[model samples]
Target: MWSPWRIVGESLLSVAFGLLGAGLAALDHGGTVRIAAAGLAIAALSLLRRTLPASVLLVTAVGSVLFGGLAPLVLVAAWSAGRRIDGVGRAVGTFALAYVLNLGMAVVQALPHLSLPRLVFGVLWPLVAIIVPGLAGRYRSQHHTLTDTLREYEAQQQRERAMIAGQARARERQRIAQDMHDSLGHQLVLISVHAGALEVDRELTGRQREAVGVLREASVAAMHELREVVQVMRDSTEAPHEDRTTPGVAAAAAAAAEDTTALSRGVAGIEGLVGTSRSVGAAVKLRHSGEPCPLPPTADHAAYRIVQEGLTNAHKHAPGAPITVELRYEPDSLVVEVANGPATRTTDNGRGVVSGGQGLTGLGERTRLIGGLAHAGPTADGGFRLAGVLPYTSPEGGIPSPEPGNVTTTFVDPTNTFWQQTPGDSLDEGAPVMNGNGLKELAKAMSRKNGSGIAIGCGMAVLISLLLVIAALGVGGYFLLNKAEEARIEPKQYDTVKVGQPEAEIRKQLPKENSFVTDGLETDAPPVPKGAKCLSLTSTESSNNPDMEPVFRFCFKDGKLTEKKSFEVRN
Candidate 1:
């Protein structure tokens, strides 16, 4: 999966690391074999850092302990391991193992000349080379992951929003189709019934009777076509059977006919609906209560459909039953109810009045669209009731209101012994609550997956690194200042040293040996006396010229100071 440019870049980086490690080994006075080994190890580490970073890190850490020239490679390897590792546990474990190896080697190397400063440096050296670089790389990796996760989450949200909008549009179109089927189909059936009654009148001419028969046929045809269009508009699950007869058309046509009025779009139309049913020999009554309040056009239309559907169902299913239509206008809403008693006659009148079964469903949808609720079920006294609550003011943007009204009446079906509930009320109770809980659980899951522990670990690593840096600087500065003071001896102190003095006494009078200035002084200094040991020290007094410095030397033999010499050495 590596790109050509990335491969080229890695090759160049490997070569650079190899050359750099080799040069450092040469500068440290390593032999040819050691230099080559260091170069190859660094080159291998750079090449495999991405694919096998942990293995490369372990190898480099061991090399650093064995060869001082390869110490710098350990940091690079640790950084790579941190960045490439998948989880906190793996990255932390790998870095800890490397640190342990380096620390163990440092401890063994320093055991011969171990002091407080050397011990502290030994521990802190590995920490700086490993812990700090590892933490920084881990932080970088986590930041990149978090950023990518946020981008993907945003894109997913956008896609979900678009999908939801599309669903809303589809449901709206289905509602419109249902409205047409319920409202227009009812009016068309009434037209066919009235035309059928007129065609049988003996007072009309033969030609006029033919025209009325044609009109009735046309209305029936229109209803059939309307059903086809509504079925096409609906989803497959709700599509009605086209072959079933339209309810109330043939039965109402067979009953007595009466003068008809243009139906109102609101509560005022209930009287006309009842009158039509009465003409068809059904016992129906209309009752009104409270002062009528103005209603929005959508709510008004919904109220009318509820009554029409109720009357139609009653005429078709409960023949010879008495029906009542009630309209109560409350302070904020209009309540419409249609209740019918038990049937007195069976539906075997040879005029099939089978229900299409979508009337009440479409009525419910219409009521909900305009901030209303619909309910229909059998009553306690062997009867059925269809009821609805409509708000006086339509909701904004045609969206249903969460709470429709304060009216809380429950009707129980005698046969089923269950309460009839509105679709809006049931969905509000269950789906929203469940969806809210699901969203909360999803958020918690994401938080757990993203690893807050890694952030905490990185912070702890940074704090420890700072403390180690401060401790190392403090210890190093103390040793440096102490050594500078111990390495200098004054002119008076040097003069006080006597030749032939006991070595113990001479040592007490002289300052501590200055290893910094005297590390290889024997090779450049004048010849020493036979069977003698020498101690070298630098003078506190500076030479007048910058090119030279003064040094003091003492030789001991036979438990006495055998020789004392002072010289000016070139810088």
Candidate 2:
């Protein structure tokens, strides 16, 4: 069904074509009744060009032949037929029928004086009027189809790229959760074990034993909560790994052991961390400067991890060195620094502790999540230092504060995961199982093979059809001009004709009849001699004067010229 706007537009187009047909009818020297009737019929039938293109085309083609004023409507109908018809075979057959009708009518009209040139001109003129516009319509239809196909293909590619990016982010979130679970859970377990040992000491007072028992219970509760949080963070489709021997799991466990050696910790737990180190006979000291201020939980956790990493590195690399942990509360930020002097004892004291160097990498990643900076390197002295600067409020307005009575242990991963996926991993169900190279090749193939072939083929056909039309017009125009020149006679030649000369001799001297110029000669010319046939020809010398046209009439009776007269007809 057509929309109202579309119907209105097409109706307006039909009205304009009707007006054009009427004007062309006015140009013809036919009776007013015939001209008006042809114009009205052309206008009425144009309305059905889109809906009944084949029928309208046949009617208009016949009308153009009979009335000669509906040629434009015939061309319009031909174009509509090409566009609305479904298949190539049907369109070609319809156009062929219209063309044959036009050519056959022209042949019948010219049968009395038909020549080879007239027949050729008739055939070529109808080809130009009908075939050219029809081919143009088909080319335009093909162009629109190709454009729509390309648009749909581009939309599909965009959807695929977005889906791939989403899967990569889900994988990265799982990776972060795994790292946090392995690192935080191991430290909590160690704290529980140490506190349980302390609670059994006979030398401790009752109050001290109660404190140790509470610490042990707290560590156990924290570990359980951490496990539950990690499970929630992992991808729901993934199953827990029962085998701990996988390389990824083993690597994670090793990195976690080097994270913290003593207790479950955070910004508030730093003092207990230092005290535990001191109790183990390590010279660890804590220092503070500037005013203390509150910090967001994510930043506070990052600061504690920085100090814990420093102490852990010191134990592994500088066993007997004096270590210092400093906490400075700047006006807008919390600065943490941990430094240890050179080692005074061998690191290989029968405790084979292997460092995989992932602790500082994980610490840096964790600090950056809260919009902080972490650094670790050798100091000026023969020592090493680890430091981090955490804003009191994160630059990104801090992570949302945890709900009351709920712990906010989950950290936001700040890195872009779209570019982090391994190329060979499956994206998800029902997606194409291909790598990055395969995707790139597929895109290139679509671009290379989309629509170039169709465009070129249509363009060539249109070009060839236009060339044929131009050539036909050129040949037809040349012949018509030659015929017009041959049909013109000079004033001197007209005056030389004798009334008593033989009709054949006078014709040999005079030029052929120029019906194009002599058809409208004045009817008031002197009456021809009784029972004599007359021939009229235009004068070439008199054509220069626009106010009058000169025509010579010669009459023949009994096989000889009887009268010759020259008339100056009004223009």
Candidate 3:
């Protein structure tokens, strides 16, 4: 819908264009009524721009046939229709109609003298008038639509972030309640136990016994209330399956299951795993050194995961190779090492079995969380080795606890940045390394999306080339003009010479060969008559628009000039 102000603005624009068109028509000897009629028609049609833009454009296009001044108003209405209309089909239809009408009118008006070439040239104005405004309007519409979409997307993202933050706060509150129940509920239970023991004392007065009974009753009541509190906290923290009401629960459950399975199947079953591998036609051996120490749960988990991952690598990469698993317990550290010999033959159905290559990466992440280091690489021999070192006890003589506030995590996609060897890197390298190929690919993708950047670069190159050419031409022109001005000329001698003058006489009257002749033109003139010779002389002009030097020709017949004329070099 067009506002009143907008309608007025459109009217003003239409009238202004009408006046301009009338002025142009007046230049072509149009009458005052014709000019006034065109102006009034444009102003009237523009009033229907908002509600009936297509209809307005049609009428204005037709009107332009009678008053050629109304063409601008026709274009304006076409543009408005294209911008305001809902469907591209309708706008395109309107554009086509206007084009046909305008062309038909032109053809009708000039039917007496229309030719293929003239018709083509006449068709160009209407074509451009229809298409350019339509395209511009289409671009404006698309731009606005895109801007609206981006704004909506940004608003949606903000809402999503607020929702996620609220969810995190709720989860945190639940976690706090659960922790209180876990840590404080036991202390309350101990108080209830002690009060019960006092209540049952063998030696006591009636009042003392009564007091003890009261104390025990109160303690029991408190313990019951505490249990209720603990139960409520547990219920809140662990919502029932039907009441979970959250996304990612299934993924969380699956990840927990995987972790539990890996822990159970990793370090605890090392010997069994080795025996199982041997049973499956793999030559494997396990060895232990140093006294076995009671390792922390985290250390044991890390150690087990390292050996499990190493054996898995052997199975996948070095199939049929003899593998050795070594567990060494130092005074402070426990090390797990797995090595394999060169692959003897294909132990699986397929050759070069493709792997997602994340087994070692996950293992590394797990070990690092518990203050351990993991390494894997090719061995000096045609084989592979995997090694890990986990500290059984931290320097503080206790298991290391994860510090939540001070931890920063950077996730590396294994598919993109595959592990690569670094300078002096050993088989125990655990730090993530980015692949060079991935970075180059990312850069190329970014460049491809930047169309304006590429266009600007090409434009700059062309501009620089143009400037250089202009500078070179300027310097060369300056030197040529300076040399031409400095050269001397014998004007009187050449002016007095006759048309049949002798070649020797003309040569003597000419300036020094090194002076004026340098800028003069030299060319072979037309052949002289029988037994005659031809001569040419070149000289610069004395004018503001001096260009090429002029050449003077002379025909010498029997040692005398016959004909002479001057010609300027064209280019």
Candidate 4:
């Protein structure tokens, strides 16, 4: 390629050569005329290149040969032509002739007596100078130009590739708009109808009623925004204005500027979410372990929609399983997790839920725009999980819209009273029919009853036995002196029955004076029955229940009471 740079360089040299030629013609000297003629010839030679093919370079080289061998431009042209000429033999042959002509002229000019040779010498030497070395320079210049041209061509190819890829992206966005119109547009219309019906129909079941209202609002909003996007694509306008006439997403956004209702229209209360799922027979639980809080309005709306979409998928796909929603707050990040166990029913439509099959992807995009991230997929244990992380910095360096209406949150009191039966929740077979509150109360009641029963049993058993022992000791002591005579005669036999025998038996050995036994139902004491027999004690009871009835039914057999009894609470 002949660049402007090359043109400028050659043009400057031509102008200089032309000026030199004119100046030399003004001087009155033979050498000056010769030199001036050479300069003019060189300048004209440079001009020929602009109009002729590169082959004209050979003609320029001839001019250099006729002028001085110092003509650099001629040398460059000769060399360029030589390199471009493909056959090596032709290049060498042509260059060799130019060398001989100029060499012969130089040889003649040097021989002072040889006039013929002198004339020949001047002409031939110049020819030689412009051809041989000129040819070498032309070859070098041609190689350099070719390398530079190839580099520029490569750069151009890369630019074209990038342009094509950009065009492809624009085309894909158009295609995506078309797909959304076909699928999401219709589904949202159905959803709005069902939802609108639920709002006015008092006879609708609660679950259906709640679901339809949310679905209706969400569908209408989604359809409106979708249509807006489609319209933008259809029109191919750069600076886009959203259409806000519809009661859909775009419209709600426009309304939220001055209305709180608009903000909550497509939003589900986070608290009611779990309850709704439970009402539909799903065993669901919700727990938030953090500062009691909420999010900015835009983030709230975006996140709530994501959660709604996720749960709707769970219900649509894994309808029978229990779900757990956990919201954990870290110092720098807010995490939302929705996990559901596998479904047991055959009707589960466990597939992608959105019409575009890009709802989650859209959620992710929304998250990114707000400096957040969202992750969603099926879990390994026949379940699904959706997670999102909303960051603090938004994409456009702005905060998400503030939430409308302050939250009036309530904290749970630990000691709140409760019941033995919960109206609804997880069912237990043998477990007490209670919530956490009932379990606490029942525990306290059982503890009280057990302590009382233990105290009564221990108190009664020990006291009666101690009284009998003391009476026997007293009677036996009185008999001890009398028994001294008996012991002297029967020492070994008395010792055998002393330590290991029952106290009742020991009491019987008290000469029948201190021995007392109770019989069933007929003790003489008012509280004790008479018939069978009775032992009366005048000592006050040490037990707290001093009004207790005496245990009258103790039967004795072979010097031991075989049956014993205690007071009964009722009659």
Candidate 5:
């Protein structure tokens, strides 16, 4: 779309017309013809948008005005540049360049019209043009910087999240390796050591020797595989690749895929895992217990890994054990279960091989990562059993598929985890709720147990607030009782006072006891008897309670003392 030849042609045309206009404007002592030519050049330059850029457009617009090239060109160039680019960087760059060029030209043009006041407006107006866009461009620059900073911060957060995830995965793998070495390594050593001693005994028959040899081979293979895994982990990135087998669930799954990146093949690829076990003298039979259904991606991965690890452990620990793996697909999840019986006596191995016991732990980690559950341990009836339940997500991305038209909606308890349910199990409410979110529920249960202390403290605080409120109410009640007792005049005089009388007039109506030798009982002597008031009763008689000191009381007209009979005893 952007042709170099077309761009060159546009530039040459623009330069030619601009020079021609300059010649006409110089010869005619004016610029009417030049203005017309510049307008024509601008129109042609605009037509070359996809091919040519603002180089031609700038020149074309400026040449259109003889002495006033500054304003016309800057304005037109800004308008043209807006339609040229989408990015802020380019737009600001174009605007800034135009501002500088326009302001400089304006100064040159105004030099000839130099009067003190005229030059001021001339320079100031052009400064406005230059500064306005420059200020706008500054804001654009700061805003662009902020956007870039935010994007960088987001990318940094993603990297940190990935790093934390990787670290957690690595730690899990290390723990798995340690468990394998500790538990399963000792078993394999016993098999190898006892078999080597039995091989030396002369009482062994030929068939017995062959079985022992197979046992030794299987044990050594498992030990070496475990060793290779440990070495690979010791310095993960640089470990030798010569003995690399399927490292984890993901690698095993990928090795079994025709195209590992594609999600369609799924658990079907686990046949490859079965083939690996059969080579190691283990017979692994894969079967389906229930009618299979379309499985969610999480269910698919969990099913594959559970079966693969079960078979792997069978081959490593119980070489001649007949292992059976059953998978069942349900509406909400997929269930995978693997069981192996005790070693058979057909070939009569000296001792069964047993490697590190990380198979079960690794399987558990894989299940938990995708909201699934896994269990693996020795079975009550001889060999071992492995089970996992993987919850499904809707392909539409949010909710699960609705119950089928023919099917009744049933809820299952999460903790009731079963790879395949028995025919006797009635689909009921919350039966599987415990097992489905067992890990999460375990954490919540612990938190609830721990928060009992905080709950007690909260109860204590509430109790203290209640006690304070009761104490404050008791204090208020005592104050109210004192006020009522002080206001006990004769019952007939209780309603005598009107409500609207002033406190000063009520005080004057009460009696007081005073030994008025000179002026008044007030501490401050006034020009007049300012503190004096006529009283219906003496202050001493008004204080009827002997326990109370003599105090002033202000009485109402009929006889009620409207003011308190409280003491003014000075120390």
Candidate 6:
């Protein structure tokens, strides 16, 4: 309401009015104090009109009545007060006061010379000044309120649109996570099982057994980490760290991070990653510097994911390129960099790698979650580089000490019944144990489980159908009753009847017996005059008590109709 632009504009307008008034007054009586006083009053009114509208209006009106050159400032203050005041009561009161002051001043100043016309003009001018501008100001205020309401409504719709988009994205991610858990998790578990069996074989040599052990450990860890990744993807909380200071949030986050790190501890897989790349027939090198220090689980997971995503990009986008993996453990942070030289040979399959750029976007989001920085771009030597730096401290703040009763551990004994090594439970003995009858029984059980759901769905459908049918029948019955009531006719045909027409023809012109007319007309006549042949034309019949009465009497003498008359027939 009192923005800088508004203040500046009002001030300029006020000054202009003040200067014009002072110039006109100087032509009549050249007074310096009058000019200065008028200008000061106008400027103050303009500046404080929005903040202290009532006070400004009252002051400016009084000053205008007392001084010669400040009357226009009253107009400006009155207009502004009209807009600022909530209702017309205050505005009307202030305007009335100003009108009285102006009128009294005019009468006092020119009483000896004032005529009736002049007096009326002086009184009306003050009313015009107050009413016209005040109405305009009220209109402007209403328009402004309407504009603000529309803007707020548009902003609310925009927020709802953004929320819907976010919800759709969340649902899609949940679906992908569920698919990964159902499909990939089962495969990894099978691999872990087979590796465990191979690691325990007695015929294998020591070196062969060592390789199997690494494979088994890697398989088990991979499975454990996969579950953690799925859980994180399915989680609805966008900012996991914002709740770290809450009672159990830190512990939950720490547990999730530890589960993610089950495959390898911090900085444990740099050499193995390079070895795998070299084994794939790519020129790869690993470099390390500084002393490795322990990192919080969140940071550790971030560092591992960064290197893993970098190597994956290299393998997919630049196959057979020489890649360099660098690790630097600074006093405050751990920096990891993976850079790949230009590809010496690219396979057809490598060119077909589908990259929608979500990988890098996801990597960036993950790094930021742990208070780390990640960068990926093309190198100057026609190569690509991916790099990241992770702080050892917790992402929320400094590392939080586990509080009492807030620690949660999922480290169950490996020899528990869930993972026990029962004898004769090898893959050969445990595989494909279900026979035909067992399969049939399993199918029956599944059908039984689904039957209740199907029955409930059908019952709901039937209920809805019955309700719709009942509504349709009620609507049909209403229309039918209305149609039957509308069948009753008025005696428009009676107007066509003539005095000398045949009695049989007049009887044919009348409505049938069961039909009724609105006019209380009788179909049967009183006993015809003497022995003259009589014919009665019916008009209406009572449905409730048909024998009660007929009021209309259409009479015919001899064979031809002679006259038509009616008499009231009461029960």
Which candidate number has the best TM-score?
1
Q: Model 6: residues >4 Å from true position, as ranges? A: 1-15, 30-52, 59-68, 85-89, 99-124, 141-168, 190-222, 231-571
- Model 1: per-residue Cα lDDT over 471-529, one tens digit each: 89898779866765687789998898888889999888776454443455555579888
TM-score list, all predictions: 0.66, 0.57, 0.42, 0.32, 0.32, 0.33
**Predicted candidate 6 versus true structure: per-residue lDDT over 1-571, tens digit per residue:** 5789977787788678767767866764557986676566566667778889878776766666566566677777778887897776877787677777778877786665454444655565566555556555666675576556555644543443333234334434543554455335434544543555466679999999899778766865675677678768756634233222222322222223233324353467657656655654667778888999888766675666666667767765676688888988999999999999887654432213333234565556555555677999999999999988888886445334334443221222223211121222212212221122333443455446644455455456446545655655566556545433543334555567778888778767653332222222322345555545443333345534555543444566677777665544433
- Per lDDT, what order, best first? 1, 2, 6, 3, 5, 4
Error of 1 at 78 (Å): 1.8
Instruction: Judging by lDDT against the true structure, name the best candidate.
Output: 1
Candidate 6 pairs with clashing backbones: 521-552, 522-551, 522-552, 523-538
- What are the RMSD figures for all models against the true structure? 11.1, 15.7, 22.1, 61.0, 33.5, 31.9
Collision count for each candidate, in order? 0, 0, 5, 21, 20, 4
Please, what is the whole-model Cα lDDT of each candidate in the order they appear?
A: 0.69, 0.67, 0.58, 0.48, 0.49, 0.58
lDDT of 5 by residue, 335-405 (tens): 88889987553222334443444566556754654556898889877899989987766333311222233
Output the lDDT of residue 48, model 2. 87
Query: Which residue pairs show collisions in model 2?
Result: none
Poorest stretch of ten by lDDT in candidate 1: 250-259
The pairs that clash in candidate 3 are 267-304, 375-428, 500-561, 520-538, 521-538
Kindly list the per-residue Cα lDDT of model 3 for residues 404-462, writing each as its tens digit.
33211113222321112222221111322222333344335544554335446545644
Cα lDDT tens digits, model 4, 489-561, are 1223333443334547644543332111111223333343333332222212233465433332233444454
Runs off by more than 4 Å, candidate 5: 1-222, 234-287, 296-304, 314-324, 341-354, 369-371, 380-383, 391-571
Error of 6 at 171 (Å): 4.9
